[model samples]
Target: MRILGLDVGDKRIGIAISDPMGWTAQGIETLKRQSKEKDLARLVELIHTYEVDTIVCGLPRNMNGTYGPKAEETRRFGDKLQEHFQIPLIYWDERLTTVSAQKTLLQGDVSRAKRKEVVDKIAAVFILQNYLDARAKS
Candidate 1:
């Protein structure tokens, strides 16, 4: 079964997809948020296009491990997505995922402008990959 991963942000939503066998995660595309209706519609289209069975949403938490307003917003988004798509949704702790992505891009000598373009999507890939790896080991 294929799983979709989302890094939800205020202006953009990064997307990632797991392999059919659920072994690995790959960065897909970034969804530019226009409106809730449009964003959800686009997400539904992606779900259908990729034949996604499950969705993994990144939940931002404070360093002290508390859910903040952003996490609450993410939960609401996930709820809406589940209601619309009728797909299973899981929340993954996304602490420092963006930081990790940034560091990775820096190591690869990616320019700041380019990193801004792909950081969220790369973070989504990291989130999904971590989930896939954990599932494989279990």
Candidate 2:
């Protein structure tokens, strides 16, 4: 199944999509947050465009594995996604994906400004790729 992954943030929402065979993930877009209605509408368009069957949303957990306000907000966003698409929504642990993305960009010598713009999308790719790898192993 083609799966869509999301890394939600206050200012932007990073998006990724798995290949049809679910073997690879590609960074899709970084959506700037506007209104909830607009955001959901844009997501719906992506769902239809990609023919996604499942949504993998990142659940930001504290390093101690406790859900805090950020996780709660992510859950709420997932709820909205489910209500709109009525698809399977999987909450995957997103512990250090952002940090990892940043490190990768730094290693590649990406400019700080460029990293700031695309970090979220790269993080989303990491989130989806990790999930796909785990699924393949299992």
Candidate 3:
């Protein structure tokens, strides 16, 4: 079974998917958030399309390992997603995932504008890859 990953933000939601063997993750797309209903609808569609058995959502945490407002919102989102999707949802610590994505993009000399457009999806990939790697090692 495949797994899906999400990097939820205020204006956009980044999507990623694991290979059937759960070996790797690749960026799918970035969804522009419209409303809660629309977001959930799109997510359901993606879950069905990918035949996802599990969902891993990025949970932003402060450097000191504390939950902030954004983290709280992420938890709420996960709760809503679990209620609607009725699938196992896991939250992975996503501290600095975005920063890592940005650094990778900069090192690759990606255009600033293009980086902005794809950063969320790349971050999602990193988040998912981390989860997959951890699972593999365990």
Cα TM-score per model: 0.97, 0.98, 0.97
Cα-based lDDT for every prediction: 0.92, 0.95, 0.95
TM-score of 1: 0.97
Per-residue alpha-carbon lDDT of candidate 1 for residues 1-138, written as tens digits (9 for 90 to 100): 689999999989989999899999999988878999999888888888989999999999999999899999999999999898888999998999999999999999999998998999999999999888888899
lDDT of 2: 0.95
Error of 2 at 131 (Å): 0.7
Residues 55-122, candidate 3, lDDT per residue (tens digit)?
Answer: 99999999999999999999999999999988999999999999999999999999999888889999
For 47-126, candidate 2 gives per-residue lDDT tens digits of 99999999999999999999999999999999989998999999999999999999999999999999999899999999
Model 3: residue 59 alpha-carbon error in angstroms: 0.3
The runs of at least 3 residues in candidate 3 whose Cα sits more than 4 Å from the true structure, single-residue gaps closed, are none
**Could you tell me how far off, in angstroms, the CA of residue 33 lies in candidate 2 after the best superposition?**
0.4
1 or 2, greater by lDDT: 2
